[model samples]
Structures are given as C-alpha cells and as structure tokens.
Target: MPQLITAPGEAVVNRYRTSVVTPRVDAQVVKRHVQLGDHVDAGQALVTLSSVAMATAQGALLEADTELRRVKQLGRDVVSEKRFVTAQVAYQQARAQVGAYGMSDRQIDALIRQGDAARADGRFQLLAPQAGTVINDPFVIGQIVAPGYELLRITDESRIWVEARLPVNEAEWIMKDVAAIVTVGDTQLNGKVVQLHHQLDDTTRTRAVHIEVANPDHRLHPGQFVNVVIEGKAQQAQQGIVVPKAAVMRSKDGDWQVFVETAPGRFEAKEVALLRTAGERVMIDGIAPGTTVVARGAFFVQSEIAKGGFEIHNH
Candidate 1:
C-alpha cells in the first residue's frame, strides 16, 4: 500500500434528511403506506392522516359552493347587490380555507366533483419530500399526531460525510477538493475534502475536517468509525526526504535527531523534523535527499557520542 497520512473518523448522515409532517391540525395517522428502510419517491404518500380541521374546511367549501351557484342563478334582478357580493366573498374564503388546510388543487377539485358524497373526515396524505429511503417512522396507524409532528425521516444515503479531528498542525494539509481515502474495515473509498473548521476544539486542540464520500451501495452507515488517510499534495511530499526509520532517534531533549555521515566512520547527530512514517521508513524535513547517513547503526552512533567519544552536533 502507498504511504498514508492516517486519522481516525466516523461516518455521519448527509445533511439532506427530511422530516415528514402532517400539514393540518388535529391529525391522526389512519394508514401507513411505508415502513422503515423502504425506499420511496418524491411526492409518494407515506401515511394517511384524518383531521377535524380538514373535514370542517371541506364541509364549508361544499356549502359555500352550493350557495354561490344559487345566488348566481338568481341574478341582480332577483338578489340585492350586497347579498350577491357577500355570497361571492364567502365562496372564495371557503376555498382558500380548504387550500390552507393542506388540500391540493387536484384534491379540492376531486372533492368538489364528489359533492355531498365526499365525506370531510379531514383525510389527507402525507408525502415524501424527496426521493429517498425511510430511515425513521415513529408513528403507527391510529396514532394521534399534531401538526408539524415528525412522523417519519427520509434520507438519501448515497452521499455521506466522514468527520475527523486532526491535529491542529496537520490542518493545513486539508484543502477543499483534495482527495482523501476512507477505509471502513477492508473496504477503501475515495473521497474529497469538503470542509475544515475555522476554530479548533478547546478540549482536544484539534481541527475538524469533513470528507465527502459516495456510498451508493449503502455500506457506510452513520456512526461507523472509519480510518481516513489524507495524502499531502505532491509538492509537499517531495519537499520531505524519505529515510530509514532506524536512522531517526529521540534526543535527550525530546527532539528527533538523525545521524548524518560527515566522513568515514564519523557520524554527526542532526535534528530533523519528522513528518510521516510508512513501515520501516519515514519522511523527514531539514535533510537533503540521497545524503549518506548511519541508517542501520544510528543507535550505536548515538551511544558512542553520548559516551563522550565526540561531542554530538545539533545541526
């Protein structure tokens, strides 16, 4: 496998989750067309709700409609102007009320066609706002629900975010649109850096990075912990020199040092910045690439220098 800059992260649901609601007041779920995990289309009915407010709206519409027709037939000669205007206004108000109660134009037309046979039990269908799978359905048939109650939650899981808290110093590498790898168990997914938080966590001192990954198969789920690898840009990687892991050692001062060979059997300890590690090798800065170093006997060199054979050099 290629060298990776690894971080721990977890999968999260995309922000497009929608809450299905009954648009009218005093609604009770009478029928449920979809259950949890079922995929549904936009405008698909998920449940049928019965409401007193809807029933009243429908009844008033029918009454006002009938009265308007009767007054129109009577003409100005038969009915006073004030009475005629009052009847017209009442019919318009009733129609608007039915619409405000969540009845669609098509539904209102259908009800009008049914006339008295259309019972205004306040029956209305709650539809899916978008095409997605039902992830949550908290209501059962015969359950009394109120307006704005979240009856169900629908989400399109094809796209998701992998949120990771990275060390504050490493935050600079997470640029928007940069490619990242998300590993869920044995599966590896390709994604891109979508976001980076401006502020660091006060407790962890780490910056949050969000990687957007495609999960068309739905294999990645929310709350699943995964491994994320963000490879630095090509130029950044080139700037760091790769050396044997054994060549790097910790100094007494807690700084990472490397043994650079200045002459035959003569090694000098030079402080180097450790960048990334891969297997038995590491990438470091402040060292020229291809320079000779005590790769295998670095620890021996450090011991010899510590014994006062020669004063260790910091450079």
Candidate 2:
C-alpha cells in the first residue's frame, strides 16, 4: 500500500482568484449596486462614486473631442499640420485621463454622446473586474475614499488553498501534484499538492505544503481547520504483514500489540510496530509469517483477557 502522511491544515482564500476593488481617484461614494455577500459577474457595477477630478477630466475630454472633430472637418490641406497633431494628442490624453479615473470605455462613449458639459456630473461606477462573490464591502454611501483605498473584496470560492505543515523528514517523500484528502468534520474533499515551501518554519521546523482544493459548493471557507492526508512515496519499501487495522489495539501499557492465539481458545498479546496504513488495512512488523493472530474483534479479546485478570505482556 502507498504511504499516507496526515497533518493538520487550514483553508485559505486562493489569492489568484481574489480581487480587491478600489478607486483610482479620490471620490465620495454615491451609491452601492451590490451588498456584501452578493455574487457579482465580471463587468458588473459594484458602486458609484462622484469625484471633482473626474469632472475636470471629462470636461477636458469633451473640449478635446470638439477640437479634433473641427480639425478633421477642416482637412489637412486647410489646417496646419502642427494644429491637427495637437488636437489628436489632446483628445487621446483626455480619454486616457478619464479611463485612469476608473471610467470604462463604454462609459466614455456614453459621456461623449451626452455632448453637453452640463451632463458631465463626475459620477461614475466601479465595476467588478472578475466574476466572484462580494466577500467584503466596508464603505458606505457618502463616505470619502482616497485613491487605492480598498472598498470591497471579491473572491471566487469555487476553489481555495489549504496549507498543510509537514515534518521536515516526512516532507521529503512528498511531491507536487500528489493526491491529498482533506477532511472537514464529516465532509471529505479531494485536492492536489500545488506547492512546497523550501524554508522550514522557525518554530515548528516543518515545511509548508500548499494544496489546491475544489470548493464548488463553497463548503470550505478561509480560516477553517481541516485534517489533510497526503499520498506520498514510501521512503523505503520493506516486506511486512498486512492486516486489518482493527486487529491492533493499545495494551494496558499504551503499546501497540495484537492478540495472538497460541493454542485452542488460548490468546496472548504480542507487541508490533506499525509501518503504514491504507484505508482499513495497515502494514506492520515484529511478527512472523503464518502466525495466527486475531484479525477481527481485537477489542473483544482484549476485554476478555482483562476480565480474566491476565497481564497482557510479551512472553
């Protein structure tokens, strides 16, 4: 059976799928299009803001558009080459300025359609850059937010990351893309090893292993604790007896041992070393081949021996 390394892990948001919504210009929140925990699609409007800087840029863009149009109608033969070039550059700069203020190209086209300067209200909407659920929305209407101020956070919860810390020695057998099983309470999730940290933790001296798990139903959440069993290559393969896990039990002295039937209806306890486990079966050492040992109902035999006041020790 293949080796399984179990460790405690934590579920965290996949940074690559998370998006932070912020404004490029200082603005006052005008209204919110989506609330916290709402699922939003890419290009969906999230919030509207009003900025004085946006108004100035929009007004300039309108002026530059009019100048460019007039220069085009006049023709290169009529207008000076320098004048035509200046108008074209000014229009492009104006468009870029508004775009930098978080206005989409569609919105800029709409603004141009309005044509009148009075209609340029400096109000624009911030849209979701990707499809995800709104995990956080900290700003309220009428709140003033500066450039790069995080107003909302969106994350695709369909997939997430699990960070598992493994002992340095055991980590050697682990490799990227290995299969892993993550248990959260009664639920089990399948995952794959995505990364392995080279540096060991300062205190634990364990390497960090990152596993990517599919969370289609969003059952796994960030900061949730889980048990991870990673499939790894065996350090060294050796011959051993494979038996049901129930065959082994802890003795009175807390050592792992199995009940061996010495003769007819006679049983004795013998210590054994556990090697590795796969599913319900385990490989163990310290026992000879063809040795008749209890493969099932080991606990019952242990209890029966205790009731008879017999000390469970090796011969």
Candidate 3:
C-alpha cells in the first residue's frame, strides 16, 4: 500500500442517513407497498402511480402518426407542400408533447405507427436506489404528489461514517492507507482513513476527514461515538551523517549552513545538504562521523562573528 502521509484524527458513526426529495412524475398514488420501519433492498419498488394521462398521450401520438403516414403515402403531386408540412408538424408536435409525460422515444414512435403506445399507467414507479430501512410516512393511496415531492425517506444506518473535523495542518499529511484503531462503545476495530480535504475553513480552521470502517455484522450504526489516531513519522532511516538540530542555522541571506569544528578552538563555516529531520536531530550529507561538528550553540558563534568576536582566518 502507498503511504498516505496522515495526521491525528477521531472516528464517529452516523446512525441516520437520508436521501430525500427526488423527482416523482405522477400526482396521485395508486399503490403503496412500503411503510415505516420496513427494510428495503436496492431497486425495491415502493409505490406506483395511476398513469391516466400517460395512456391518453399514447393514443394522441398514434392518431397523429396515422394521419401523417396516410397523407404522405398519397400521390406526391396530389398533396401541396404546405399541407404536407402542416400534417408533418402536427404529428411531430403531438409526439414531442406526449414524451413529456414520460414515454420513451421508441414507444412514442411505435405507438404512432401502430396507433398503440406501450401502456404508461401514468403512475410512477418508486424504486429504492440504495438498500436501507424505510422511515415511512410516505404516501397513502389517492395522495397527490408534485414533481419534486418526497414520497419516501429511507435511512441506510448499516453503512455509515462519522464525519469528523480535523485540523488543517495535520490533515494535510494524511496517507491513503493510514490505519487506525476505532473505538465503538466498548469495541475496538481496525479502520482505514481516506479522502483528506486539501482545503480548510478559514473561520473554524477545520478540515474534513473521511474515516471508512466496515460494519459487516450490523454492529455499527450511522451515528456513534468513536476515536481516531493519525500516526506519522517525519524521518526515514538510512545511511547518512546526522547532526543535532541546533547545529543547522540560517545565514544573513537565509541560506542553511553549519559550522565544522576542524580542531579545538578552531572552526570553519561549511555548507551541508539536509535530507530529513528526526526529533532534535537532522540527517545531512558532506560531514563525516569523526569530523568534529559544532553540535550546539552554532547560532552564538554566528552572533560572535557578526559582532567581530573572533579573528578571520587568513585566506
């Protein structure tokens, strides 16, 4: 797995998730199969609408199509161009208008040719887009539903996550394969942290952290108490020269440089390349292990030199 480069975080479980306010075509309900507290699977039909208008539109398209075909089939010289166009326009307009009622293009065309459209009960078929438990109060038979009315509400409490707020600075280092131990009530399970938001809120100074945990046995609900640990190491172990963090300093020009102690009461300013840093120590190149390095108070020497505290070596 690739390193996610993660930071500290907390875990949470969201108990109730609602997907509501979808498009409903029909105004009146004819059949209702689901009720409150019902477990529904994906694609389960919850309700059906009475499609009176749907069937009517099919008939209209069929009539228009028959007229169009009859007029066009007659000797081309017998019908004037304008009359032909008028019939054509009428048929096309009827076909388009009926489609707004939710008939497929093929069905509308077929109905025009055969004078019979595939039966649209003018009723709506409500299907569960996801698997979850129904939070009823949907609709009773004879209830009128508008275009954007919410007929049903389902809560998929089984698959849920706690949306946790994390600090921006720490969230920036999140690794995709970050592992954390999640605490759910008295239970502890291993989980993975993912989808760290690169942007942070200016006012709250928080970033969104998505922690995904599996609840196969249905042990976890949508909203629950949990904690997250974001562990990270800033340094990589390898063969290299190591220097105390204090030995590295900025010059007047803001460049990184370290002083090498060539001998007792003797020092020389030498430049070194920094690799990575551990706690209080930095790994650098160019300086050997036995080479006397000014491990401490290098800044004081810089200050001393700035104040003319020591003699300059003859170049």
Candidate 4:
C-alpha cells in the first residue's frame, strides 16, 4: 500500500473557469441585465452601456458604407484604382472600430440593415462570454466606467481547486496526478493532485500542492479550510506484510504488536515494527507471510490475554 501524507489545504476559485467582464472603450452603464449571484448563460445579455466613441465609430461606418456603394456603382474608368481601394479600406476599418467598441457582428449587421445614420444611438450590450454564475457585479446604472475597468466577474463553481501545503520532505514523495482525499469536517471528497510547486515557502519551508476537486452540488466554497490526505508513492519496494491498522496495538511497554493465532481459538501478542501507513492499512515487519494473524478483533484478543495475566511483551 502507498503511504499517505496529510496536509492543510484551502479551497479556491479555479481561475481557468473564471471570466472578467470589462469594456474596451469608456462607457456609461445604462442598465444591468443580471445581478450578483445570478446564474447566466453564454451569449446572455449582461449589461448595457452607452459610449460617445461608439456613436462616432458607427457614424463613420455608415458614411464609409455609402461612399463604398457609390464608388462601386461608378465604372472603373470613372473612379481611380486608389479611390476604390481607399473606400474599401475605410469601410473595413470603420467596421472593425465599431466591433472593438463592443458591437457584436450581428448587431453591426442590424445597424447596416437600418442604414440610417441618425439611428446610431451608441448603445450596446455586454454579453456573458460563457455560462457561469455572476459572482461579482460592482457597477451601477448611470455610472461612468473607464476602459479596462473590471465591471463584473463570472465563475463556474462546478469544479474548484484546493491548495494544500505539505512539508518539503513529504511533498517530495508525491507527484502530479496522485490521488488525494480532502476532508471538510466529517465529509470526505476525492481529489487529484494537479500541480506541485518546486519553490518552498520562505516562512514555512513547505511546498504548495494544488488538488482539483469536483463540486457538482456547489457545496464547496472558496476560502474554506480543509484537510487533505495525499497518497504518496512508496519510497522503496514493499517487503513487509500489510495488515489492517486495527490489527496493530501498542503493548504495555509501548511497543507496536499484533495478535497472532497460535492454536485453535488461542492467540498470542507478537511485537511488530511499523513501516508505513496508507490510510487504514499499515505495513509492518517482525511478521512472516502465511502467518495466521488476527486481522480483525485483535483488540478483543489482547483484552482477553490481559485478563489471564499473560506476558504481552516479546523478548
């Protein structure tokens, strides 16, 4: 059985499954389609904003569209090659500028279908890039926000990360993809080690191990402390008998011993050296293979022996 290393861990949001919402241009928050803690879907409208820069870009696009159409209608003999190319480039640039201002391709197509420059209102909606819960929505309606400002944050809580801190020596025994058990109070959750840090903490001399856990019911939350038991690879080949941990007990002299069945319905205490522990199983020496050792109810056998005043120590 593999050895187990226990460590302290904390649940954290998985950054890979989180998204930040920000505007590319300075805009005023006109309205909010969702509030904090609301579940949202991909392409859902999250908020609406109005920007003067977007209005200017829209007008420029409309003008460029008209000019391009006029140049196309005219014969090549009437329009110079440079004039035709310049009109096409201007139209493309204007379209790209509007898109950069947060106008989706569909919205741009609608704007072109309208064909009325007077209708360029500069209002556009910010959409959810992916399906997630709205963990943060800090902006309010009518607030003027600058470009690159974080207006909202969406995160998928179905799966999260638990960062465990292990001692330098114990961490060296484990590697990525090792199975781990996380204990949150009395509940035990299965996880796997996804990352191992090479650098040690300056204060604790411990290495960080990241374990990914599934939270299908959203029971796990960020900032919660947890106990993590990582299954580590054995440092050496197994050479001892593996038995249930309950089969081993400390004798009166504090030596680890197990109950061995010497005859039918008779048992004797035999001292054994503890080698390693893997959860509820322990590997021990001072015992031979094919030996009839009481795996379960060993404590009961020990109690019966103590009643008879039998010597429990090995010479």
Candidate 5:
C-alpha cells in the first residue's frame, strides 16, 4: 500500500525575532507602552526609561555647547588656537556620549537645538526594532532593569516551522526539500522539508527534521506540539503492497502471518514483514499487488490452515 512516514514534533515560531534591550547602565522603567501579545510596528514606542547616566550625558552636552559658544564670541587672536580646538573636541565628545546612550541622530539634533531645556531630562523611549507581535515582556512600571537586559521579545509569526524527530534508522529516508504535512489540532498544513540534522539525539536516538509552513493568520505558535507526516518521496520509488491490519495475525511462534487465497476456497498461510501501521491499515511486503487476499475473517482462515483441514501453500 502507498504509505506516509510520520513522527511527533513541535511547532515553533519562525526565526525572525527581535529582543528589545535597555541601553548601557541601569535604568528605571517609567512607562510601558506595549504589553505582552501586543502587535507592534517598526520604530513604535514600546517603553520609556529613566537613566541617571543619560541625565549626566545630557548635562555634559549642554555644558560643552555653552563653553564653545562663549569661546567663539572671542576673537581668534583673543583666544589661542589650541584653546578653541580643545573646546571643539569637548563638544564633539559630549555628542558622542549622548549617542552612545541610545539617542538617535534626529533626537540628538533636536536636543542640541532645545539647549538647556533638554538637559538633565533623562527620559528616553525604546522603540520596536521590527514589525511583530510582542511575545515576551518581563518588566514592571517601576522595575529597575540592568544594563543590556532584555525587556521584551517581538516575533514575526507570518510563517512557522515544525521540528520533528525521526528514529535514526529512518534517517536514510529523510532528505532536503521533501514534502511533509504538519497536523495541529484540526488544522493540517502542507510544508516543505527545510533541514535535516546530521547528528542524532543522544537520549532519544532520533534525528531532527525541520519543516517550514506558512501561517499568515498567526494561527501557529511556538512550543505547540504537533504531528508531522513525512512523505518519503524517494523511498516510494521502491514500494510495497498495502494490506488491512486485520488480515495479518500473530502466529503461536510470535511471528506475524497472513493468509492469501491462491484459488477458490483455497487459502495459504505466509509470514509477512510489518513495515508501519496507520490507523486500521498495515503496510506489508510479502503480499503481491492485485492478488485477491482475505480482507475479512482472517483469524478463521489462519485457524483453518493451522488445523490442516485444507491444503495450504505459501504465496
């Protein structure tokens, strides 16, 4: 019978993720504009923070600008060239300090224009790096976040992947660019095999197979377990005949046996190899295609053959 290889797996959000982090030193979360599960766009404000270091940087910028302006008012001869150059360098360093504090170029320009009004404010906004839904947010309004700490996570859910594990023995059947199906709840999606792991999982003794599927409506989520049905397109080149599970019975010797009808009312008992079972169907190899075989009452046929009441031959 035509068959499909299946394995259990988990659905994961696609690789596009953005981690929102606080700048350099410790900062207090003053406001949270976005919450968990909120959809955000690129450059949208997600949080507001207050930093002492940012206050100091802004003060220095204001001080440097004041000194540079005061020195410029003096004639070139009145101020030594070395003194003017030193003031200019101080102003540039102050700008660099604010830039390092996570202030964008436009914000820096506006602050420079605002002069003392912008000094010591220290209020800064953290914007989303990409358009995605917020999946993780671990901050409170008054929380103090350490330097470089991740405040939130944004994930693009337009597409998702299923990571399935197959036994090492089945590794030979897995290949790149194969067709696969992922089933989650009542939803079944067609996916493409995107990756195959070279190493086996030490504990499970299974290899990883990654299948990517489209989730345009954001229906699939990470950490959701699903079933993966892999179509062994290459393995199908060498095929086997399919039979009903009831047609195959276990012999007293612990081997699987099936009865095939060679002629009218004449049956034979043959041992068959079990490949894989899906639902009520079993895929076997010893049976030939298009040959009439007992689909029902197989146990009686096996009993009749065992009793030697009828002629039995291997088909």
Candidate 6:
C-alpha cells in the first residue's frame, strides 16, 4: 500500500564543545595564527610563545650535554669512576625534564653535545591536537600565555548533534524517519531522527532527543538555534470510499449519507454504510468507485448536501 505522509520535523546540527588556551606561561604569547572560523588540521600551529622558561630549559639541556661528553671521555675508565658517574647522572636528569614536555629525542641529542642550554624558554608554538573549525580564538598579537591558559577553542564540525525537547504529551510515535527541517536563521537543513531520549525534563515536563545529520556539505553549524516539527501518523484501514468526518451525516433516524463531488462545484447525495472513522478520514462501504468524496473544508459542502437543516454540536 502507498504510504501516507509519515512524521515530519525541522532540525539542525550541533556539537558538544568548549574553548581552550594554555595557562599563563613566562613566555610571551607572540601571536595566535588560528582565527575564529578557520579550519585547522591536526598538529597545525595555533599560537606562538616566547618565554624565559623555555630558555632556561634549553640552557639546562646544554649543561647536561657538556656533562655527558666529559663522562663519555672517561668511559670504562675505573680510575675516574666517580667523576664519570656524576656527569652521566646530570645529563640523564636534564634530558628527562625536557622530554617530559614533548621535546623531541633529536633535540635532546643535539643539546648533549652543545654547551648551550639545550632548550631556552624562547618563542614557542602550539599545534592543534585535531582537525577542527576554530570557534572562539580571540587572542590578539603579543598576548602573554602560560601552560594552563586557554588560547582558542575549535569545534570538530565534521559530526554534529542536536538536542530536541518534546513534551510528554508527545509520544514515541513522534520518532524515526520524520521529515525534519533544521534551521539556523535563514539557513535550513533536512535530517531524520537518530534517537529519542529516555529521560524526562523535570521543569518543562519534556524529553530531550538527539538527532544526527550529515554535515559533509558543511551547511549546518554547531550550537545554532533550531525548530523541530514532528508530524505523527494517521491511519484508518479497510479501504473503501474515504470521506471527511463532516460529510458523513448522522440523521435523527441514525443513518449516514455523504456528498460525492460529481463536478467541480456540484455534488450528488449518496447513501453510505460507515465502516470506520479515524482522525479526519472515514471509510464508508457501497460508495461508488471513482467517487470524489469531500475530504477537507467540507463543513459547507456537507451543509449544502443536507436536504434539511440538522443540529450539530456547537462546542
């Protein structure tokens, strides 16, 4: 059987998100390269920092390197054993400190040979951890930054989620492939129900559901306001002539007749045996085939079909 228009709704894309920047460091936050709305690839630099801490770390690294060389010179020499052990220990300790903060092994090796501080808390650059769209990066040039400060916030826009609230009065019939139009101002997106929430809202007495919509087209933005309309189903089985409830008249004698639209504005009164009525549609037996029964805005049409005026419930 042909399907009636099922559930339909309006929805949009959204994501769980937050902004981040490093805590204030001794280094000057030289600049923020990633800006709001910019798409950043994984490991791409977003902020640069120049700091005394970096310089100090570098210097310590160099000192360790020098000590390592002196220790190596006495390698396998038991007589200079204590001096060799001290130098080796110093180098190993310094190397560990720098490595703890993501320093590369190659950089550490170079510092071992060089007497200069292996690392200097100099200008530093921070890279993006994942590919995402920058959302809240308002850092200006020359802003000082630290390890725990927030530099910027980027949202992974590839996948987005939407939270829709439904009143308990609206039942589970409101779920599934409902046609939904998600709107962000003038922009609109179409999506279907991915899931409905199980928990109920205490204050609003509503349930919140989550929807997933493909945004590979990048039309939908995260955290945008959206409106959803859930169109529910209507069904009356046992196919026969379908008529509007209004046109199926109940007489004082308890009989039913419907106005069959034989012409554009003309109709013929036809007696019908009622099978069932569901929602606004009714199934009636013995109705002529190809009969155009009135369905909508049928109050006036029914009145015209009535040979004599009859009482109808006003309320």
TM-score of each: 0.68, 0.88, 0.49, 0.83, 0.72, 0.57
lDDT, candidate 6, 110-221, per-residue tens: 6544544434545446667667788776567777655666677776766566667776655455656655555555765666666677888789777776666666777666
RMSD of each: 7.4, 3.9, 14.2, 4.0, 5.8, 8.4
Each model's backbone clash number:
0, 0, 22, 0, 2, 36
The whole-model C-alpha lDDT of candidate 4 against the native structure comes to 0.88
Superior by TM-score: candidate 1 or candidate 3: 1
Candidate 4 lDDT tens digits, 1-315: 667888789998888899999999999999999998899998999999999999999999999999999999996899999999999999999999999999999888889889997868788889998888888888888999999999999989898899988888888889889899989988889999998989999998889999999999887888899988898885733657999999999999999999887766667889999998866788999988988888877877788788985443331
Name the TM-score of candidate 6.
0.57
Worst 10 residues of 4 by lDDT: 306-315
* Candidate 3 C-alpha RMSD relative to the actual structure: 14.2
lDDT of 6 at 61: 68
Model 2 residue-pair collision total:
0
> lDDT of each model, Cα atoms only?
0.81, 0.90, 0.64, 0.88, 0.80, 0.62
For model 1, give the 10-residue run with minimal summed lDDT: 15-24
State model 3's lDDT.
0.64
Off by over 4 Å in 4: 184-190, 234-237, 292-315
Candidate 3 per-residue lDDT, tens place, 1-315, comes to: 121233333434433456652443555777778888788887777776655665566566667777788888994798888878988898888777666654546545555555544543354455676787776455678887777777777767654564556676556566665665566657766666656667777888898777666766666654455655543423322557877889998877776788876666667677778776643567788777788777877877777767855543431
Q: Across residues 232-309, which tens digit of lDDT does each residue of candidate 1 receive?
A: 655555446888899999999999999887876577889999987854578888888778877786887898899987
- Highest-scoring model, lDDT: 2
Q: Highest TM-score, which number?
A: 2
Q: Measured by C-alpha RMSD in angstroms, how accurate is candidate 1?
A: 7.4
Checking candidate 1 for backbone clashes, the offending pairs are: none
For lDDT, candidate 4 versus 6, the one ahead is: 4
Ranking by lDDT: 2, 4, 1, 5, 3, 6
User: Can you give the lDDT of residue 166 in candidate 3?
Assistant: 69
Ranking by TM-score: 2, 4, 5, 1, 6, 3
Per-residue alpha-carbon lDDT of candidate 2 for residues 158-238, written as tens digits (9 for 90 to 100): 989999999988899899999999999989999999999999999989999999999999999888999998988756444
